[model samples]
Target: MPDRIFDFEKDFAGSLRCIPMAVRLKLDLVGIKLSLRQWSRLDRDQRGRLLEVPCGGAADRHTIGAMIEEWVTATGGTIDRIDPADSANWSNTNTVPEVVVLQAKGEDVSAPSLSQWRALTDQQRFALIKLTRPGHENKNFVPAMREFGLFLAD
Candidate 1:
């Protein structure tokens, strides 16, 4: 699996503070709205499987969703739906989301240009959109930019 955990994960690097992008993508695909609290209740091994499990096909999605559902149930957490607004606009690589641009400006990092956005994979785009949403702490926004190669190390 790709190293989706950013340095901003802080204490979460080992157990994870926030849900990683890889798992988040799967959650979005499966339409499950998971919370940080629920994610924290899971053991390291379960979280690790979420990162390693493939969610690329019908079988994969079914398996991954089942695993997540089981985990949520075991944790006594309920599965919820991801906000549609939070999930859309990822397919249009031609245009960068305004929230991302504003977040980049706040961090003094340049937002990815249209061409750069176009070059990114769908997963990459999804991460940016999710990270830059309103009301998020956004500590990982800069780190994500670096991870995506939109921002360079100082």
Candidate 2:
């Protein structure tokens, strides 16, 4: 990750642009199963626009999920499920979940406060979680934290 927001076009040209973690979040939030290659074909503006679309509030969950599914299907993808509960709720510390816990394995990392994590954009949190995954060679969680502007220099 970089200090700047990820530019899909520049960074992942001619390659499968959707990383597994991002895909997971996208699927969880949008309730879609988008192919990595299909996602790569989308331009930066498209991706940015998707991120800009807010998907919060209790009343809007179903509506938001439907809109996301529509977008995915229109883009040649499919909506696999409608359950938004599967989405990662990084704001919840009491139930950090097994996958996230596994990611923190072997690292002397402290979980940030809910407010701290919530203050970050979804992408930043997603990057941190992905970088912290077990067996991930990069293990660049620290670097990601700094890059996302979540860490200040001493």
Candidate 3:
């Protein structure tokens, strides 16, 4: 909700080296797959629209989904859906999920306690879930945690 860009994203902000959280959230809401190529095809105005678009109401979701389809098609990209179970995992906050705990252990970092995990904003939680997913490169997991203020800045 803060519309904050992480310091880790600064290198990519100018060239869109990676898909930012704002655009990723929009893609998630619409059940669309967006490749970096498709993202590059979008002009600044289009990317700005993604960052600013409202996707809260049911009607808004429909409209945004349609808009994303059109953009993806125009860019010669394909669409895809994330599994509901995987999506649901991000919203669960009752405890720190084991995968994340394992990821932290692998990194030799302490997994946050349940209260710290619960206190994270949905976006922060979502980012952590995305980062810690098995077989993911996971290069950004620690950086995301630092950006989310779960760890001190170096």
TM-score ranking, best first? 3, 1, 2
Which residue runs of candidate 3 sit more than 4 Å off their true CA positions? 81-87
- What is the C-alpha lDDT profile of model 1 across 1-154, one tens digit per residue? 2435545554565466568877888788777888888988888889888878877666877787788888889877887766423345776876898988988999888989999988877777887888887777878778878877886798
TM-score of candidate 2 relative to the true fold: 0.53
Residues 1-154 of candidate 2 have per-residue lDDT tens digits of: 1123443223443233443444345456655555556565566555554445455654444565666566667777765664554434554444544454455454444445555666776656666665655565744665555555554645
- Which has the greatest TM-score? 3
What TM-score does candidate 3 get on C-alpha atoms? 0.84
Q: What tens digits encode model 3's per-residue C-alpha lDDT throughout 1-154?
A: 4444567666776445568776676577666777778777877787777777776656776787787778877877765655312446666888887888888888877787888898887667777777776776888888877777777756
Top of the candidates by lDDT: 1
In model 1, the runs with Cα more than 4 Å from the true position are 1-3, 7-11, 83-88
Q: Estimate the overall C-alpha local distance difference test score of candidate 2.
A: 0.52
Candidate 3, residue 46: CA error in Å? 0.6
Query: CA shift at 146, candidate 1, in angstroms?
Result: 2.4
Angstrom error of the Cα, residue 111, model 1: value is 1.7
The RMSD (Cα, Å) of candidate 2 is: 5.7
